[model samples]
Every structure is written in structure tokens, then in C-alpha cells.
Target: NMIEDSEEDTHERYEVEILSKENRRIPAEMVVESIECRGEPGKLVIIRDLTREKQAEKELKDTQTFFEKIIDAIAEPVMVIENDFRVKLLNNAARELLPGNSETPFLCYKISHGRDTPCEGKEHPCPLVEVRNSGKPEVVEHVHQTNGKERYVEIVASPFFDSDGNFVGIIESMRDITERKHAEEAIKKYAKELEEVNRLKDTFLDIMHHDLLNPLGTAMGYLDLLMDTEDQEIKSELEVVNRNISRAIDLIESATRLSKLQSKNSLELEDINLREIVDRCIENFSYEASKAGMKIENRITQPISVKANKIIEEVFSNLISNAIKYASEGTKVIIEAEEKENSLRIKVKDFGKGIKDSSKQEIFERFRRKEKRSIKGSGLGLAIASRIVELHSGKIWVEDNPEGGAVFVVEIPKK
Candidate 1:
């Protein structure tokens, strides 16, 4: 083939194997030049050894294969992009999910975003640009479009360098975050809806305070004036009306307080003496307990301090009030406290009909009451107490009183 291709004053080259002086095979390149020497047809032949160049070429091909296999073995989509935005190499995952295979000269933006040029703008920032500017790794989110479908992906890009430590391009790994993006959008929508609901609840609470409580107060005052009569029957009927009106007022007040407490995420905490709060609550209910023929026992001794707000007093007030109201006449209501490693536990006990196990948890919810109609309550006392304890990073639960009634337990963190 070389001889046929060779012409006068032209050279043709061919790769051939030759025997060396030691009878060993060696690769050589043969160059033949046809010329007219003194009007006679002649040719000049030269041979150059190509063994070192062939070995170096094989080593380079092997190294490329090794790196390509390593990249292909990775699960996440990875690509090497040039500074000019042209994609240099990509793994199997990138080839499958992205546009333009390894055979094509494609731009990174073109392959991932299906754009005609490099990615720009705030919504789709170029990770290569960021890495080049910072000379560090960067994580950015980009919307990748493939086959008319869009998916969210988070790209971790690092400045890729050559063996000489010179910046060449960027190496990026892509993680699909389509599901996470959808979840975030859903959470944002739900948060907006919850905000609107909270606004409506505040409006309702305002109406309850001004519209409902004011009328009930006026009616109670009128009924009180009418109750000053000699007619015993009229007096009794008016007393019933007064009691019912008072109960309605209590119910509305309790609802408003509980709603306000539930809306707060945190509370102002202070170092409070637990005994003083319990003693004050007991004193407040002393008249009611005496009327019910109940004895209040302050079993708490040794000054105990807890990190809580003043509203914490309301929790003990509710528990003690419930104890006095529900216990049998002449029974004892015991208030005790204990200190643990990280929290303070208080128990308010009553010596009456104990709560059943099934109804214990339900009793802490709003408007949950005992089956007896004789008991008078707004039904929100325990629920209000529960919310206050929760806001103080405390816990409240009901247990059976060993002495025959219910025990309300409250756990408050020390710090």
C-alpha cells in the first residue's frame, strides 16, 4: 500500500514490526520517499523505532479506562464540565438521566437544563461559575428538564484540578430533590392556612370577651336585684337563673384563657417558689373547700424553686380546685412535691371517687367531664392546666390516688 501510494518527491509512512539485533520483535515506523535519482527511478527508505510511544499510548488509554469505570460505579449522577460550559465526561447515571451521551460534544447547561447557552439568572445560577469564583465546593439547586418533564436536583460542585494543581473545570454530583421540593411547598401552603385559622380564632375570642361576657354580666346583676324579694318561689327560680348565668360566664372565660395559652409557643420563665404558689392556691380555694367540708393539706415542705412563669400558679389552682370540688365531703386534699434529677414533680391528691384508667388521658382534653351531673364545673380546668404546663416545658398526667381518689401529677423542668 505504501509503495502504490508513494509518488516522486512524496513520502509514505507505514507501521511495521522488525527483528532487532537480538532477534526480538520491535515496533517501527517505515517512511518511503520515491524520487528520480539521475533520471532513474529510485526510493529512499527510513525506519524509526515506535516502542516507547506505543507503550505510553497504551498506559494513557488504561488510565482513562480506570477513571471512567470509577465514575460509572457511582450511584449519583456526576459530570466533569469544562470552564467553557462544555461537558467533558459523565458517568452512567448522568448519561441515563441527562441529555446527550458521552459521544456528543454537549454543554452542561444544554444537557441538564435543555438550554441553548450557559445557565444564568437568579433562579438557575451556574454552579461552575460559583466554584470557579470561590475555588471551593458549592451546593446549589437547579431545575433539570428532560423529555418535557422537570425535576428538582441539588448539585454539589467542586473545582476540578489537573495533576499539576491547575484549575481545569468543575466536578459536580447531582442528587434528585423533587420529592423534598414538593414537601416543602406543601408545608408552606399548610403554614399559610394555619395562620389564617389563628387570625379567625383571635377574632372569635375577642367577640366572646366583649359580646358574650358583657351581656351575661349585665343579666347577672339584674337577676341579683330581682332576687331581693319576699316571694320564695320567685327567689328560688331567680337563683337558678343566676347560677346558670354565672356558669356560662365561667365557661366562656375558661375557653378564652385556654385558647390564648394554646396560641403561645413559649413563656417568660422565672425562678418561682413552688410552695408559695401551691399555698396561695390553697388559700384562694379555702372558702370553697370549707363550704364543701373538705380539708386542704399542704404536704410540701422545704422551699423548692422552678424555672417557670407566673401563669404556672393557674395550673396548681385548677388541680386544687378540682380536688376540692369532686372529693366527698370532709375528705382530705393533699398537695405534695418531689425533686428529681432534671425536673420537679408535684402531686395533688383527692380522697374521693378515683378516675378510671380509660378516662385518665381524655380528662385532660377540653370540655371533658365526669359522668355525674351533680358536679359543677366549666370542664376546661384540667385542659387549661395542661396547656400551661406544656408551655413551661413541663408535663401533666393523672394517676390513681392510693388513698381512694385521683392524683394529678405535674412535672416541670428545673432549668
Candidate 2:
């Protein structure tokens, strides 16, 4: 306003909002200039209708804002890193994990780890490099120390490509797993403690068993001498004593044998007669069975040879004991064997109470027992037997007795 004529007419462009004849505001861009070539005196004015352009720009801005909000709404931290390992796009969750200071670079390593370069070496291996090389997704777990505290995070990374399908960069998703890591470590520690406790228990049993065997042997020896006196009363009393002493010894020995079988991974295999084992076990249990007024039927008369050890005898002993112990007054236990192409099958069936379907497999586990059963046992019989069968590369399972009781089966392969 103070320049008077101002040496000539000035040229300028202006953005202006104009009210159209329809009474609607429209955006416009105008250029004004004085057209003078020494004699011309008119001024030139040009106007551009920028309403459509402005509308388009506003719509694009809204769409970009909507997408950014959606990305930030996700719970897990997500980030997109360029080929040069610079952070390109990150959501709100990612921002919280990275440095917030203005001086920190946008590069992923620098923002998240305060490192000048990408992860390197075993201390901090970057999974993004693996994705770029393999063109496949990769997951890695890392212990991150930030803000004076350590936490574990698992990162899953995948290769990113441009719209044209050209390999460009990587996108990563990360989750904090510090609590889960702590839980796993606690489980491992408890397992170690349990294993040590079992070892100590077995050692104590061994020491006590060795000291008791000597006195038990002396009592049995004195009873055998008294039986030769030919006095009927003394002989009968001696018989009862000998039977009870033998039973105690068998019980002690069973505990030790069970412990030994559990600690071993394999059995010593040899040429063994399974039928002989059954016959001997039947004779061994004859006294108890007769006392309970029960008879055992040994249907396996034919000799079946298998690649097994003396532990095979213990297997049969346990089966027969279970049958006689669980069978009633007049019920008989039947020992049956079938020969197969790959193995031999033996069943010890009792007619009293068959195991519940739910407890059939569980009874073969250590210290597991059926509810409301009065029969006393250490509950380690079938576990030791199953282990032996497994060591011989065979299988053992029990089936419901169609008659009335459980049919205990054992199978071994011929060498």
C-alpha cells in the first residue's frame, strides 16, 4: 500500500475460498499479473477450480489415518524393517518397546537395542538376516535387557516384498515370554529333585535289606533242622514258621527287584523256557493257593522258548501272585500261552474282580492302585513286569475277562 505504483504490477498466485452462486463454499487457486509491454494497460487474472483436488487429498488423508489406527490396535508388537535394517513402519506396541527419545535413530537396532548396527554374533543373532537369506519365516528367542531389567522375547520374522513381488525387507512380530521361561525352569528343577529323592529311597532299601537277610536265613535254617526231629507237632509248627519266613523273604526281595528293574533300561536276554517259568511259579505259589482253597490251572504245557532272562521268572511270579491274591475261595487261575509268528502270548486270568476299564492301564504304573480294594500290595508288580517286557522289545496289556475276572497277558518274541 505504501509503494504507490510499485514500479510495475506485481505477479502472484493466491489460494482463495469463494462462495458459488449455489451458496456453497468452493476452494480455488488464482494467478494475477499485469500484462504490460510498454503500452498494454490491462491486467490478467487466471483461476483454477481446486475443489476436486482438495477433496481427493482429504479422502486420502482419512484412509491413511484409519489404517494407522488399525495397525496400532493390535496387541502384539509389530514392525516393518527396510532392506537396510531401518525401521520403516511400526505400531503403538512396538513404539512402547523401543526408545522414545528424539535423538534415537529410526533404525530397528538403534531404537530397540540402542545399538548402532543390526544384531550380530551369538549374543544377539538377528532373525531378519535369516529371513532375507532363506526367503522364509524364522522365529528366535532372545533375552533382552532394557530399562535395567531382563525379559525374554520371542520374535517371528518373515520376508517382505514390494507390490511388484521384488524382495524388499522384513516384517516382524514379537511376544514377551519371560513368564513362560520361568515356569519351564521351575519344572526342570522339580524333576531333578524328584529323581534324587527316588535314588536315596532305593539306597536306604538296599542297606536295610542286606542286614535283614542274614537273620532271616538263620531262622529258616533252624526250622529245617527241627523238621527232621520226626515229631508231628513240631513238624507242623515248623512248616507254618518256614512258610511265613519264606513269604517275608519274598516280599523283601520283590521290593529290591522292583527298584532294580526301574533303574535299568534293558534286560539281559538269553535262551529261556517260558513254560518252565510258569510251571515253577505255579509250584511256588501252590502253598498259598492251597491255604486259600484255590487251584491254579497251568494250561501252558508245551515249552515256549524266548529271548529273555531270569527276570522272565519274576514276570510270571507277579502275574500268578496277583491272580491268587485277587481270586476268591473256589476260583481257579488259568495260565494260557499262545505261539505267534513274531512272539509268544501268555495270559493269567483270575475269576474274582476284573480291573475297571479306566484303571487297566494305570495299574501298570508305579504306586497306582484301584479304589476301595482290600488286597494289600506294594503296587509295583505290573510296572516292573511291563518294563521287562518293553526291554525285550515286546508288548504287554490286560483285557477284560469274558468269564468274570482280568486276563493278564504277556508276549515275548522267539529269538
Candidate 3:
């Protein structure tokens, strides 16, 4: 029980007693009284048991310490800036980057642009000022300086806020990408070298093919002469020989043209009427188309002019020849042209074996044949055609014909 008493002189006193379970009294250490309420004489006491609270506080401190260590261990430079563009905090990585010790606090005057004039004694400072003002990240690749050194860096900046949604600061992270840049450059160099090597190989193949044509012609002529005096059965055999020789000659000619077009040097470009060129190429192949029991249809609009090399003639010739070669007998090969804005688009459509989607992109690569065992080709035709188109600052691609076949489109700039 607790009791409060007031004397007649207006003085108040407070007393508290503790009792055990056995009903025995326990000693009281001290008590407090309210001076303002003498009549009530209220008593006040304090009791404390802080074991659990102390444990919770210790756990929280340990977690914070662990995270701080982790932040300091990061390899990339990390920093925090206030909304006012003031530097607030930075890690060890940032310290190594800045011109000061870790103990020194990062001030706006010390790290911003023009700081070198009064802070670090230099004409230019860092680029962080622009980043902070714009609130946007900045990226820079391999940059060579006047000191004969190169550096590649990517810096990302983002805004920060407090729990109450008040603008607090900004965070900036920086990473070095010099090694990656060097690797990419090395890959480019190797690719260039490989292209050059392929060109040289093509040149060698062209020379061999061209030299074989003369002997092949002579052999076919003698075979023809012999067929004039032989029996019917022997004459039939001579015809087979003549056919094979013609096929060989065609293959060699295609190879020679491919090699000449793939040379490292640029082609001689001249202004020519697109319709005239297409007509001439179609006329040249007219005899072969007629013999194959096929019709050649031209849908050219008119005097469309283009600045391209003479190789364009061969490009069209190969396409038309392939169409004629592969199309079913009596199928028509359509050659059409349209004038596009600033360019000319020519399409060659053949009712033949349509190229599969998976093989479309691969067809542009050298020596990639769909029917390798069955097709009689060096497989350089389409690859050479693609290269020729690219050299003319044009593009060539294949697509499926709506009805049932393949369509090859060639786009060249009119200028």
C-alpha cells in the first residue's frame, strides 16, 4: 500500500511500502512527492529493465556496421550529393578518385567545375557539375588525352529523397570500360583482315577459272567436230560431252566474275539509264531463256537513272540466270522496276524453289549453299552479288513471293 499525508502547516509527504507473498514488509529506497498538490500528496517512482532494449540496439548497430563495410569495399566509385548540388558522402573508391584523403569531407567548391582554379589549382575540374545540374547520367568511351593516355568511363547519376519525400541528394556511380573498348577495336581489326584474305582468295580462284576457259572451249570444239562423223549412238555420247563442257564453262565464268567484283578496290561508277541496262541484260540472256522453255517479262517504268558500277549488269545477269536455271519449264521470270524517293527499287521474281526463312540471312555469306551435294556451284554468286550491292551504297535482300517462289529486291540510290 502507498500513503500520502499533509501536515497542518501545508507540508506534504509521500510514503510507499512493498509486501512479499508471505505478507512481510520490504524496505523502500526512496519516494517523490508533488509539490503543487499538497492535499493529494501524489508519489512518483521509477523502475527499469533494459536488457531486451539493449540487445535490440546492439543488433541494429551490427547490421549498420556490416552494410557500411560492404559499401566501402565496392570497387567502383560511389558518391552521394545533396539536392543543392553539394557533395554529401563518398566511399573509399571515390576518395581514391578525388584529389584528397578519405577523412576530408567533399565540398561543392572542392569537386565541382572550376574548382581547380582555387581548390586543386587547375584550369578544368570534373564533369560532375553538369551531371548534377542536369540530373542525367553521362557516358564517355575510350578518350585519348594530350598526355598520351586513354580512359573510358561511364557515369550514372540519379536523384535521392528522404522518408518524407523531401529532396535529399543524388547518387553517382562510375565504372571503367577501357578494356571492353580495346577488345571491340581488336575484333574490328581482325574482321577487316579476314575480309582482305577472302578477297585475295577470290582473286586467285578467278585467275584459275579464266585460264581454264580457253582449253575448255578448244576441247568442246573438237568434240563437236567428232560428232559430225560418228554413228548415231556415238553422236549421242558426244552431245552429252558437249553439254557437260558448257555447264563447266558457265561455272567458271560465274567464278571469274565473282572474284573480280570482290576486289578490295572500288568499282568504276557511271551514270546509266536503269531501263537500258536491264533491257540489255535481259536481251543477252534471251537465247538461254528461250532454250529453257521459259518466258522473260519486263515491267520497267522508264528512264530511271542510277550511279552504279558496270558490275550491276553482272548482278542482274546472275539473278536472271538463276531464275531461268531453277524455274520449272514454262514458268515466266518477271523483271520489274519502280522509282522510289531518292532511289530505284528493282525486283526479280522467279517461280522456283523458294528460300527457307532460316537460310535467307546465311545465303549472303560466302560459300553457303542449301543443297551442297546436289547444286553445281562454287556458292559465291549471291555472296558476290550482296557485296557488289553494298559497294554501290545499295542493299539487296530476298523475300518469299506471295504466289509461290522467291523475290530478290535490289535498291540503289538514284544519285
Candidate 4:
């Protein structure tokens, strides 16, 4: 065939297979030229083996196919886009996202966005264009409309380079984040509703404080005058009434305080002496402790300054009062402090009934108290203490004392 083609065209080249000694087919390239050698008309032929070249070509194709299959197996849509906004290569997921009728050298913007030009804007910024311009990777969020349904997609565009380290284009991995976006929007809406609900609750509490507490105060004043009449039975009856009125007042005041503390986001902090605060709380509760046949052991005598506000005193006061109220008669309530690397750990331990493991966590929530009915409380005290400690970036928890009691621990930042 090469000799016949050389006779017509004077020169020809053919790629053909020839049989080897072992009868195996071998690929070869042959060149045939019509020539006059030694004054005779003949064809000059030259043959070159092509088995290695063919093998190399097949290996390259197989490598490309292997990587293409790996890319297609990925869940997220992947595309290799050229600098001209053309889709050079794509995976199966990308093919599903792109147009089915898209031809070779597909324009990415046209196939993906149904647009004639590249995407450009603050909201729908083009990550491909950014990568091309900056020669760096970029991540961007895009809202795509397909079949009249909006889809949120996060595109991670990375710079693609050839084997020679020359910049080629960008490889983009597109992840569908529509569900996550919807969830975030729902959370924001729920948060707004909760904020409004809290505002209404605060308003209602304020109204109750004004309308209920003022009249109760006036009634107490009348009772005080009535008790001065010097009638024994009447005086005892008024004393009971006075005690009930004071309890009602305390409940109302505690609720108001807890409400205010819950509504606050931050506090004005200062350098306060923890030892002084604890001592003052002990002094304030000393008479009550003595009346209950208990003594408060203050082990925090040394000057220890902590970053907190005046309200921190309320934490210690509540703990000590609670200890005296619950501890056995003649038992000592110990107030101790241990300085930490970045904070202080203060423990108010009482030789009383310890908190149950089941109710230990529940006790910190508002209106959730685990105590006997004889223990008169508004159930807002511990909740208020928890909120104040939270405001100071502190933590409070209860533990069982080694000597058969409860130990309330509070940790607060030193600085």
C-alpha cells in the first residue's frame, strides 16, 4: 500500500502493524518515497517502531479516565473552568447541575447560570473570576435559580495548575447549602420572638411590682398601727399577718431582682476584694446563723481581689444564708477560697443534707427548687445567683461534702 501510494504522490507515510518473529503484532510507522537509485525506479522505505509511543499514549488516556471517574464519584459538583469562563472538565455531579445539551468547551456562566457573562456582584461574587484575577483560592456563596426554585450553593474555587507548574484555570467544588441557610434563618426568627417574649415578661413583672407591692406596703403600715392597741390575742394575730406580709414582700422583691438580672447582657465590673465581700456577708448573716445554733467559719481572711461588681456580694450572702438555714444545729458552715491560675474557687460548705444528683442540675433553673415546704423561699435565689455568676463569666455548681453535707462551689475570673 505504501509503494502504490508513493507511485502516485511521490512520497507517503503510513502507520501499520507488522508481524514479529514470534507472530505477535507490533505497531510501526513507515515512510515511502519514490526515488531513482542506481538509475532504477524504486521506492525508498523507512520503518520506525511505535510500540513504546503507543503504550505511553494508552497509559496517559487511562490515567485521565481514572481521575475522571474518581472526580465523578464525589458527591459535590466539581468543575474545571478555564480563564475564559469555559468549562474544561466536569464530573457527574457537575453534569447534573449543568445543562444536558451543553457542547464541547462549554461556557460555565451560560451552562450554570444561564447568563451570557460571568457573574459579578457583592452577593453573587464570581469565585472563578476572583481566582483568575488574584491567582488564589476563593470561597463564595451564590443563590442559583433552577426551575423557579432558589438554591443556595457554596463554591470553593481553587487555582488549578499544569504539570509544569503553569497556572491553567480554577477547580470549583459546589456544595448545596440551601437547607443550612434555611435553618439559620429559622433560628434568627426564633431568637427575635424569644427576645420579644422576654420584653413582655419584664413589663408584666414591673406592673405587678407597682400594683401589688405598694398596696401590700400600705396594708403592713396599717397592721403595725393596729398591733399597738395592747390587746394580747389581737397582737398575736397581727404578728402572724405581719410575718405573712413580709414573706410576700420578699417573694415579690426576689422575682423583680431575678427578672432584672436575667434581662441584663453585661455588667459594670470593678476590682473587688473577695475576702471583704465574704466577711461582710458573714457579718450580715452571723446573727441568723447564731439563732439557728450554727457558726460561720470564714477561712478567706487574706485580701484577695477579683474582677467583679458589687452584686457579687449577693452570691456569698445567698450561699451563707442558705447554709445556715439548712445546716444541723451546732454545726459550723465553712467559707473557704483557693486561688487558681486565672481565677478563684470559692466553696461554701455546710454540714447539712446534700443535694441529690438528680436535682443538682435542676436546682439552678428558675422556679425549680428541691427542698421541704418548711424551707421558706421564693425559689428564685439560686437562679439569681447563677445568673449573676454567669454575668461575671463565672460558673457555679453543687457537690457533696466529704463530711456529709453540700458544698456550693463558685469559680470567678481574677482579672
Candidate 5:
């Protein structure tokens, strides 16, 4: 339709052509020409109103452009591969992703996997085959080598059908996940390093354990020589030295066993006399108790035999040390063992400020302490004791002493 110069100058509305029989005027194109109809000369006129058709064509073109823009806008590589594994379409990203072969319909295997033939299930999965077989979407992850470097990609592929509802091809989208792959590898590396550090720590501990006791044994051997002297003053000093060395030995043994317990290593079990174990613990802790103005009272004189290991003795040693350390001056620390139906209960009670009601269970965890108790300790003593007891199928707990202190108890199976 063309506007006339006269129509533009008028203030009134311009002419609106009618379409078919409708009264409402719309845009139309009409052509009149001379023609011969049935041997008679007549002018034939044809008119076509193109407003709806033009709008529909514009809308369709805009929709097609929008979809094309969307496909090109994605950063991930995308392609449409037919059932024969030939690439039907590829986006700008995919074209740039694959370095060459822009003008050719390349095989998907050649572009992705650099293979001359299509992917077979024996070596690599073929998404086209799988999607056709299942008539559904499929996903796969692959590591490809390009430019002397490896890259991991996650491929999401879906089946595409023609307008006739027949399978035509598969739409495959690829996302680069090489960064995530590196992160997983880093985690595995760190785990291996941590394991190595733990092994070295264990080795260091073993060396320290052995090296420390060797010199202490030598010192004790020499002390025995001095212990045979007749002079009372020299003998008395040697006795003190012997007592301190013995306590040091007990501490080293405790440390060794505690470290081993952290690894959950198996302990050597043997028949042990509970009475002798208690007596030995009291003897080892006598110096510390005396320094705190406390005395240990052993109430278990009868021999009580049980199936336990050498580490079991450390349990009583730790409990006795705690009692003596926490109890007040001039207080008595009592130790007793009672035979039960299927177990033996060892009780160590101290007459001093008792443990808090809430801390009975918390005291057994690593590095936990009551805010009110100011005694200096590594805090692993009770934890180690609890672990050793558990290994022996035993239970260890603390209760409020009837005499204004705490009573620690350990119950172990007699077998």
C-alpha cells in the first residue's frame, strides 16, 4: 500500500480499504490488469488483505530468532547428533569448543573422543545408542585429552523426535567439570598426607617410648647399687630416687598405652591379679599422694584374679591419681574391689570436693574438665581409662561419695 501526497495533507482520515465483505477497513493490496476471459476482453482485479498474515509471519520469525539466540547464548557445548552418530547441528559454543571441522558434518566420536569410529560400549559409552534403545534421556561423564591436557565433562543427552513422532536424533549438552574433578583429587591427596603424618607420629612416639625407658632402667639399676649402702642418709635419698623413677616409669607406660588406644590397636590380654595391680598403683602414686597430704587405703587384700591386660592396671593408676589430686589435704583415698554375679567392681573414693552431677559422663571425653576443678592435667587420663575398660568389656563411672567426695568405679567381667 502507498500513501498519496494529497492524503498526507488532509486533516480528515485517509481511505481504509475493505477486506472481503467485512465493513471494517484494513490494509489490502489490489492489482488490476487487462485479461481475456472466455474470448472476451475484461479487466481482472485481485485483492489480498495482508495484515494478519504479515503479523503472524513477523511473530514466527521473532520466535525463531529468540530460540536461536537462546541456543547460541549458552556457554556449554551443545550438539544434535543423529542415530548414526553424525552431528546434525552445533552451536557457536560447540563450534569454538571443537577447534576445527566447522564446515563438515563430523562424527560425534571424532569431535568429542577423537575416534575414527563411533563409540562402542566396550571402551566408551555411546549416548545416541543408549537414548534410542531406551527412548529416554541419558547422561554420561567422560575425561578427554586435548592439547596435552585432560578435561572432564558431564554430558546430558536427550532424545529428539521429528514432527511425525519418530526418533530422529539426540540433543547432547556438555558442561565442563574439570575444576570439580581437581577438587576431588585434592581431597584425596590431603587424606593421604594426613595418613602419612599419623604414621610418622606413631613412629616418633614408639621411639620416644623406648628411648625414655632405657635410660630410666639404667638409672634404676645404678640406684639399686646405692640402695645396698648401709648409711641411713644415703639409703633414704636412694629410696626417694627409686620411688620417683618408678612413678616416672608408670607415667611412660600410661602414655604409651594411651597413644596405642587412639589407634584402636589390640592389647595383649593375660590373666592378672587385681589385688597386686591395686597394690602396685598405690605404691606408684604414694609420692604424689603424700605431697598432697593424702594416704591411700587399700581395702582389697584378697587376691581377685581377672582376664585383663597390662593396660588394665593403668585404669586404677589414673583413678588413684585423680582422687589424690582432687581430694583435700590430710584426706584418705580408699580403694576396694567387690566380686559381683558376673563382674568385679573396683571402687576408689576420695574425701574432698566431689564431681558435679552433670559431669559424670562428660568427664570421660577427651580434654573435658569441670570449671571449678583447677587441677592441672592432660585430661587424657580418664579418657584412656575409659577406653581400656571398654576394650575389656567393662564399665567405668564416677558417683558422689556419701562422705562429701567422689567415688570412681570400674566394673569388669571376671572371665
Candidate 6:
């Protein structure tokens, strides 16, 4: 009976071995004997699938490395804070912005103020608290002093959330706007100086034009008397002189008007019918257009109105006259107006040689001319026009026309 029982037990053990081998499972007997000798019986002996576990571990390591790289790569100072306002993570940029003794923990709020007092217990809590409570990003602009240098920093704080939709903490970013602020201030100062210089120039021109008028009038009177005498050769010479003097006087007057328009000053506003203003401009330039053998066409239909100064007339006159001067003889110049939702758009189209793209940006600047030096112009027309448009709270730009030419469009607010 004992021999038979041993045979049966051996058969059962062989069956178990066959099953384990088929499934590629580790043999229990190999591990069990070693474990039995140890004191701890409840200890776990896990045979993990090394392939999957190693892949997961490598992926986790890669994610951590990527996060660290991103944090270090940011140019602005970044800090991560916990709900209790303790510093959790800070980048290299933050350390450089607020460096101190290695033994001391770098507290951002405290270091920003350069105060010895802790930010947590101070009279004014850290601004980040407001951002956390409001659940929205908050921005504050202030001057910060560090290492005996003052800088303007714009602090931005935004709330962070976890995967479970719990409020985790806040991420704070600080940027130095000192250089941009300084540049803006310098521009304003320069604009003021230019304004003063322009005023002085206008005053000088006015005085000179006024002084020249008296002698020019006397010359005109003497030339008229010479014409009355009818000495053919002398009369012809006097007529030429008279014509040249008239041209000079016209130039002086135009310059005076342009100086007034280009002055860095505000305009007196009144609600006026824009159509009527455009009509008067067309009429003023009609004779000049005829002399140039150019035809003027108006496409404006409705009565568009805007709050503007009387200088709008001069602006259009100068633009139309330029269109006439540069266009081919007998080419048509079209003035069109359309009413926009909040603004009035007026366009002056000329079939002249279109300006090059390189020169378009600088054409509105003072003393810029596309024509050759021989072209009789002081190069102040477009500059004066731009200044007048600015005073009227308007914008002007140039674009290429579909039909081989250029279009100058002026947009002014309706109200």
C-alpha cells in the first residue's frame, strides 16, 4: 500500500511539472526551498515582466527630463508655489534674478522687495494670493530693486489644476520691461523736441514770407506800368519776370499753408459734410488739372459726414495736385468715397508710375520724393498730408491698384 501511494504522489507531481513547463512559468520548487530557509515567510517574490516594466520606467525618466529642460529653457523667471505659498520649484532664471547666500532659501516675494521681513507674515501678503483666490491670472507692474539697480518687472500669476480638477497651486512668471519702457519714454522726449523745432521753423518761414510780400507787390506794380507802355521787347521781358514772380509767390503761399498743416498740434473739430469739402477741393484743383491736361472724376454719391478740421480740404488738394503732376498727360484721376460701418473711406486713384515696394514705407516721411532731383518740389507734400490726417484722427495708406497704378486710401472715423 505504501509503494502504491508513493507512485500516485509522483504521478501528480509530474503532471504539475508538465503544466508549468507548457505555460513557461518559473518552477515553484526552485524558489520555495530558498525562501523556506529565510526567517520571513510572508515576503513577496514577484517575477515582473521586465520588458514592460523597463519600457515604462524609461518613458517616465524621459518625461521628467523633458519637463526639466523646458523649465530651464524659459527666458523669463518662473516659480512654482504650493497652496501655502512655499516655493516648490524655481528655474535657473529665478536663481539668477534673485541670488543670495547658498545657505538661505530663496524667497521670491521677500527678495523682490529687498526686505528682511518674510513675505508670508508681512502687512501685505504676496500678490499671488489674490490670483489663487480669484482663480484667474493677475498681472502687476512695478519697479523692483536688486543689486543697486532698479528695473520694471511685470509679474503674471496663473492658477494650476491637477488631473482630478483640484486647485493645485499657481505658476508665477516675471518679465523685465525696463528696456521697452525706457525706449518709449525716450521716443516721447524726442517727439517733444521735434515739435519745438517744427514750431521754430514755422515761425521763421512765416516771418520771411511776410517780409518778402511787400517787395514782391512793388515789383508787380512796376511790371504792370511797364506793360502799359507797350515797348514790345521790354514788355516781353517784363511779362516773363512777372510770370516767374507769380510762380514764386504761389510757392511761398503753399509752403506757408503746408507748415501750418504739418504743425504738431491738435485741430479744432466741427461736424462737416465730407462730400461738400471734397467738392470744394475738386473745384480748387479743377483749373490746375485742366492746365495739366488731366481729367478729374468723382465717384462719391451720398453725403458722408465727419468731425474734422478745415485742413481736410488742403489734404485732398495736395493729394489731387500730386496725382495730376505725376500722371501721364490726359490720364483720368478718380476720387471715390464710401461709407464704412464706423469710418469713412476716401480713395484717390492715379494712373502714374506706381511707387516701388522698398520706397512705400518711407514715402510719408519728411523730404522723401520718388521723382528725380530735377523734379521741382520741396518734397514736403506727403509729409504735410500725413500730419494733417493724423491731426484729424485718420489713417492713410497706399496700395497697388488692379489696373496698373497706385491708390491712396484715407480712413477717418465717422463721429
C-alpha root-mean-square deviation, each candidate? 3.4, 5.9, 12.4, 3.5, 9.9, 11.4
Candidate 3, which segments miss by more than 4 Å at Cα?
1-91, 94-253, 367-378
lDDT of 6 by residue, 198-271 (tens): 88997888776898877888889888877886578988888788877776676676577677765557888899
The global C-alpha lDDT for each of the candidates, from Candidate 1 onward, is: 0.88, 0.81, 0.70, 0.87, 0.81, 0.74
> What is residue 374's positional error in candidate 1, in angstroms?
3.9
Query: Model 5: C-alpha RMSD to truth?
Result: 9.9
Quick one: best lDDT, which candidate?
1
Residue lDDT tens for model 4, 1-415: 5576557337778999999999999999999888877977888889999999999999999999999999999999998888778788888887776543456677887887788788999987888878878889899998777667888989999998889987788999999899999999999999999999988998889888998899999999999899998789999889888888887888899999998897799999999988999988999988988888898998877899888999999998988988887665528899899889999999999988788999999988888876755566777789999999999999999999988889999999987
For candidate 3, report its TM-score.
0.51
Decreasing lDDT order of the candidates: 1, 4, 5, 2, 6, 3
Poorly placed runs, candidate 4 (over 4 Å): 1-12, 32-46, 99-103, 145-149, 161-168, 229-244, 264-269, 299-301, 328-332, 338-344, 372-376, 401-404
Query: What pairs collide in candidate 6?
Result: none
Candidate 3 has its poorest 10 consecutive residues by lDDT at 116-125
Segments in model 6 whose C-alpha atoms lie over 4 Å from true places? 1-203, 227-244, 328-330, 359-363, 369-378
- Could you tell me the lDDT of residue 406 within candidate 4? 91
Q: 110-139 in candidate 5: lDDT tens per residue?
A: 887778877777346788887898999988
Query: Taking the tens digit of each residue's C-alpha lDDT, what string does model 1 give over 138-194?
Result: 989998776677789999999988899988899999998999999999999999999
TM-scores for every predicted model: 0.86, 0.68, 0.51, 0.83, 0.53, 0.50
Q: What lDDT tens digits, residue by residue, belong to model 2 across residues 1-415?
A: 2123333567777788878999998999877777776787655678899999999999999999998898899898888888887777888887776554424237777776777778877767787787888999988877766577787889999997989998888889989898999999999999999989998988887875897777999998888887898688988888878877876776677678777777888767888888888899999999988877788999987888888988788788988887777766426888898889888899988887788899989988877765436455667788888888887888888898898888888888887
